[model samples]
Target: MLHTNHAKHRMPVVTAVRLAAMYEDDRMLRSIRDLAPRPEEPLSVGEVIAQTPIGTKVPVTLFPTVGINRPGTDRWPVLIQGLEEIAHWVRTQAVPRLITGTEPPEPGLPMRYEISVGHEDERQAMSAGSTTSAGERHKKALAAASARGDLAEMISMIDGSPSEPQIARWLAQLNHEEVLERMSPLRMAFDYDPEVERHNFEVLKGCRDAALRFGDSDGPHEK
Candidate 1:
């Protein structure tokens, strides 16, 4: 399922970029009510580990308009590497949980929604420890998403920090295949023409090449 998801990954990006273009299309659309509302003040980032309805699934007909600035995810995302993972999680766990009412889901792919309402200088890495910010991996992955030109650059511009090198490496760690799975439809609408299927197809391959370059960038013979 993951392999097939990877194979068909390009469409998601094309669709994502298409989504990125929405605000640019009609500034008036911002007033829509049913869509996730932009908060007057920033919302909290909940820790789903303890309280989120891990595997609950709801049938969604429309793509929920998310992050006001980024137009991506509203909730802190469930990091999935493929479409099939989502399906499996929803079908096996979420549905059963819905039926049983008391059955809780085992975490990971199935666990997405964070129940706790929860961040500024605390926002950037948004992770904390007994001392200063000491979060690892996934935070770095989030940073990489914010730094990449093909992505966060178009949605909400972010400046680089000491975390730059780590995020780049983390983004590289994503490998090309995993990237397509993680993306919020990358803002290709601002750049690529969605009408041309081949162009969209090639762009993802180009992303793969860039991933190779990141891997090489750290080598003694950096390409």
Candidate 2:
């Protein structure tokens, strides 16, 4: 969520390096690529672990391998493998940095399978402007209930919602944004439930409101 120009530029460099590394031996790289599960495939974490090189040393935490029908989910395995290999090479070969076309990995956490899958599906729907899934609708209902101070309903909804930023943004709105901005650091450090966080809700709401207010209205100042 913290965007930096350096971090944004790092991906392509790492990607180019990875591609170059594989350029020498197409077949081997292809083999590794093949071993990776397809987005449509129902791959479990166990399957992913099995496919990784034996005794491979990974520098960062890896999410359970998932076959995602959505864009971000589809990239997860490739991104993970690319970074791990790069990290390994850096340590062993003393390479200082390797550029990649991959985003930095999310911090590792225990995730429920349902939550992960539901999240991927929800992202796809939102991006595509498709109808919201049952899970998302349920989450919205729960969030609305929470706003009304119904703790019991909030708890029930939380159980079904995916671990995603959108849900958190909605939840943040209920508590208002100014309070959230003040506590952004604490929210980043400790909160697992993004939806319940006052800060996230505020930040997201601010962005949404700004976008809506300015997106359509033409002005003399408009570029």
Candidate 3:
């Protein structure tokens, strides 16, 4: 009777061991490409074997466990290197495959579905809001630069070094105190969004004011 009960306990233990082994195998077989490689070392053996096939996220998970597998060649292989290398190999191989009548792989369904469902109005609103926020930040940055007598640096940071022609035009606009009119020509000429043009004009005007304040040196110029 003791032996009979002992057999029953042994059976469950055996089953549990088998299940644990199977789970370990599955874990070992998973694709680790997306997982960051351990720092301070080249690729590891586990990573080499855990690579997925080209153009697919599905893991290969099985290899001969011996011999070198040169990637992107007619030879035994289990995996390759980084995604960029894989992409390059695919592009290199694609033309020949297409010439022989193989269809190119399309993007996965989820990406296509997301693109199809994109909300244009929401995107436009988001872009507009971002532009507005950037403009406000630019003005504040320009003011700070002006106070420090470094308007040129702020102007360069805003966009880039303005051309001589551009500086002359901005100077005329600033002298006329016509910031809105300046924005119109700059927007059209530079192909900038209206908000960006307005922001740039304000930055220019701030620089001119800063220059005048520095030149006067008698006192702050009357507004």
Candidate 4:
């Protein structure tokens, strides 16, 4: 069915249809989520309704269709505005990343550098720039590595050799860049495997050095 928002914005037909379907699904899911079968605990809804489907690569915290039953809380429109950017990243950043094999595989790391389909899910982190906080600083470094199209450098940042301050500095110094390049990082990543999961970001480039200084024997070393 044609939606007003769809016509107004002229979004991709498939995307618009998918978005519309969520509203319909949300209407139903929220109803079940509200049901409290136990009469004794009516105030407390025992049912848990997940906002996202299982195995989603999107952010787990925010649901575009969340609060569909409540007015002024829908975020689908927010996502709609960002669809182009998201699409661009998937096509340019994520797709190229997936197709291109990780080069110069790090010593003692996974020797299997050949990418299997569906592992290059880190759209947000790789596209991040240094503006927000320490977290963003790290992602910005990864994003810089990604822009250079160097997967090995990305691994180095996560595993060994502190990524220079120059990368983020260079991005900030740029007088002109693509709109996509300047957009704030969306904070997402691949969860297809534990080795490549977003949580691996926890141990960044400087972590090992800091650990060595602090004498934490458990810190991850070069691999």
lDDT of 4 by residue, 30-110 (tens): 333454322211112444434556786443222222111111222233233344344444444555566665432212121
Clash pairs, model 3 backbone: none
Q: Tell me how far the alpha carbon of residue 171 in candidate 4 is from the true structure, in angstroms, after superposition.
A: 1.5
For residues 144-219, write the lDDT of model 1, one tens digit per residue: 5554645322212232221334335546566443654545344334334666545544544454455445545756
**Candidate 4: where are CA atoms >4 Å away?**
1-47, 51-162, 175-223
- Residue 73 alpha-carbon offset, candidate 3, angstroms: 28
lDDT of 3 by residue, 1-223 (tens): 1123443346332110010011223344334353343222223444543344588565232212222223222332222222233444344454536655655443211111123355768644433332222334455555443433333444434443443333333344342224333333332323447787676677566655544544345343333
TM-score preference between candidates 1 and 3, better one:
1
TM-score of model 1 (CA atoms): 0.21
Q: Where does model 3 exceed 4 Å of error?
A: 1-191, 218-223
Ranking by lDDT: 1, 3, 2, 4
- Return the TM-score for each candidate structure: 0.21, 0.18, 0.17, 0.19
On the 0 to 100 scale, the lDDT of residue 27 in model 1 is: 31
Model 4 misses residue 193 by how many Å? 15
RMSD of each: 21.0, 21.9, 24.0, 19.4
RMSD of 3: 24.0
lDDT of 2 by residue, 1-223 (tens): 1123564455443221111111223223323444443243344443432234679643432233322122233233234444444444443333222333344332211111244334547644434442333344455565455443322223224323322343333344444333333234333323367565766455445544443343334232321
List the global CA lDDT of all models.
0.39, 0.36, 0.37, 0.35
